[model samples]
Target: MPSEIKLVNVPALGKTAGYSHLAEVRGGRTIYLSGQIAVDAQGQSVGTGDFTAQARQVFENLRLGLESVGLTFNAVVKLTVFLTDMQYLPQFRAVRDEFVNTAQPPASSLVQVAALVRPELLIEVEAIAAAP
Candidate 1:
C-alpha cells in the first residue's frame, strides 16, 4: 500500500476476517473502476456454472483494470462485490485474497443480487483505488 493510504480494522466495528473496516486516503488520485465480470478480453464468458472459476476471472479482470490505470491491488482502498448467491462467499474470498493485499486489505462490501448483466455471470467486483 502507499503512504497516502491507510486501512483500519476498527475494534469498535468488530473484527474483520478478510477486509478492513475503513480506509483513509490523503493527497492522491482516486480511481473508480466499473464492475468487472467473468468475461474475457474477447467478450466471451470465461466460466459457466462454476463459481470458483468465475470468481477467479472476476478478480483477474479487476487486476487488469487496476493495471490499466497504472495501479496495483495495493492501491485499492475499497471493493464492492456482488454475488448471485451468498453461499459462494468462501470461494470469493479465496480468489480475492490471491490478488489483494492481505496484510492491509481494503474496505469492502458484499451484496447478494438476483442477477447480473449476463445470466451466466456469478460474480462481479468494482473497486476504488488511490494513488500518490
Candidate 2:
C-alpha cells in the first residue's frame, strides 16, 4: 500500500465482512473505473447464467483496468457493486476476496437491481483507486 492511502474500519460502524468503513487518500492521483461486466476483450459474454463465473470475470476486468494505469488491487480505495439479485451476495464476496486485500479492504457498496443492460449479466463492478 502507498503511504498516501489510509484504510479504516470505523468502530462505530461495527465489524465489516470484507471492506473498510473509510478510505482516505492524500496526495495521489485518483482513478475512476467504469462498471465492468462479464465481457471478454472481443465483447463476448464470458459467463452466461453462472453468477460466480460472472463475478470472477468482472473482477478480472477491473484488475486489467487498474493495471492499465500502473496500479494494482492494492491501490484501489473503493468499489461499487451492482447485482441483479441479492442472493448472489455470498458468491460475490467469495470472488472479491480472491482479488482484494481483505485485511485492509477498500470501502464498498453493494446494490441489488432488477436487471442489467444485458439480461445475462448478473453483476457489474466499478472501482476507484488512488496512486502516488
Candidate 3:
C-alpha cells in the first residue's frame, strides 16, 4: 500500500456502499488513465451485452493499466465509472468489490449514461492512481 495515498470514508457522507468518500494524496506522481472499456487486447469484447461481466472486465482492464506503471489497485485513489444503466448498480458493485480493496477502497463516482462508444459495451471506467 502507498502511504502517500489515503482513502477515508468520512461519516459526514452516509455509509459507503463500496467506496470511500474521499481520497487524499500527500506527495507522489499521479497518473490519469483513459476510460477503459470491456474489450480484450485482441480487439474483441470480453463480455458483450452483460453488465456484470463487462463491469468485471473493466476492473481487470484498470488493474492492468495500473500495473504497467508498477502500481497495484491500492495505488488507485479515484475511479470514474460510466454505466449504460443505473439499475445495474448492485451487479456492478458485486464485481467491483472483487477487484477493489474494501479496507482501502478508492473514492468513486458512478454515472449513468445514455450509451457508450459502442452499444455492446455496458461499462467503462477511468482511474486515477499515485505512485511513489
Candidate 4:
C-alpha cells in the first residue's frame, strides 16, 4: 500500500525551515523519523568538540532512531543534515557512508548553520523513511 505524506508540525514551533509541517504515514502504518542528534541512549551528548566523532555518533543515533520506529537506513528516502561548519562536510560524509549503501543512495541535503542545540554539537540530521 502507498503511504500518505503529511507535513510534520511539532507543537513546539508553529513552523520550521526546509521541513514539512508534519509528516503523516497512513498506509505504511510506520513512523518516519526526523534526523536525530548524536545524543546517546542516555540522552547524553556523544561527540564533543570533534566534528568527525560527532558525525559518527550522529549516524549511530540515527540508526537507533530508525530502529525505534521499526525501520532502518534502507527505508530512508531522504536525509537533511545541518552542520555548524561546512569545513567538516567531507569528514562527515565519510562517516555517513558507513551507514548507507551508495549503490542506490537516498536524496540528501547538507547545510551550514550558525549553531546547533549546543555549542559543542557540530552536526544534526533528519530523515524521511518508507515502509512496506
- Best-performing candidate as measured by lDDT: 2
Q: What's the CA error at residue 49 for candidate 2, in Å?
A: 0.4
- Assess candidate 1 and give its TM-score to the true structure: 0.98
Per-residue lDDT tens digits for candidate 2, residues 1-132, read 999999999898899989999999999799999999999999999889999999999999999999999999999999999999999999999999999998999999999999888989999999999999
Model 4: residues >4 Å from true position, as ranges?
1-30
- Model 4 accuracy (lDDT, Cα): 0.71
**Candidate 2 off by > 4 Å:** none
Off by over 4 Å in 1: none
Candidate 2 pairs with clashing backbones? none
TM-score of each: 0.98, 0.98, 0.94, 0.75
How much does each candidate deviate from the true structure in C-alpha RMSD? 0.7, 0.5, 1.1, 8.0
Model 3 per-residue lDDT at 99: 83
How well does candidate 4 match the true structure in TM-score terms?
0.75
| Model 2 lDDT, full chain set | 0.96
> Per-residue CA lDDT of candidate 4, range 1-132, in tens?
134533344668664333334344556644456667878878888768778888888888778878887777766667889988889878976887888755445656778999888777889998777776
Backbone steric clashes in candidate 4, count: 11
Once superposed on the true structure, which residue ranges of model 3 sit more than 4 Å away at CA?
none
Candidate 3 achieves a global lDDT of: 0.88
Clashing pairs in 3: none
Single out the weakest 10-residue window by summed lDDT for candidate 3.
1-10
Of 1 and 3, the candidate ranking higher by TM-score: 1
lDDT scores in order: 0.93, 0.96, 0.88, 0.71
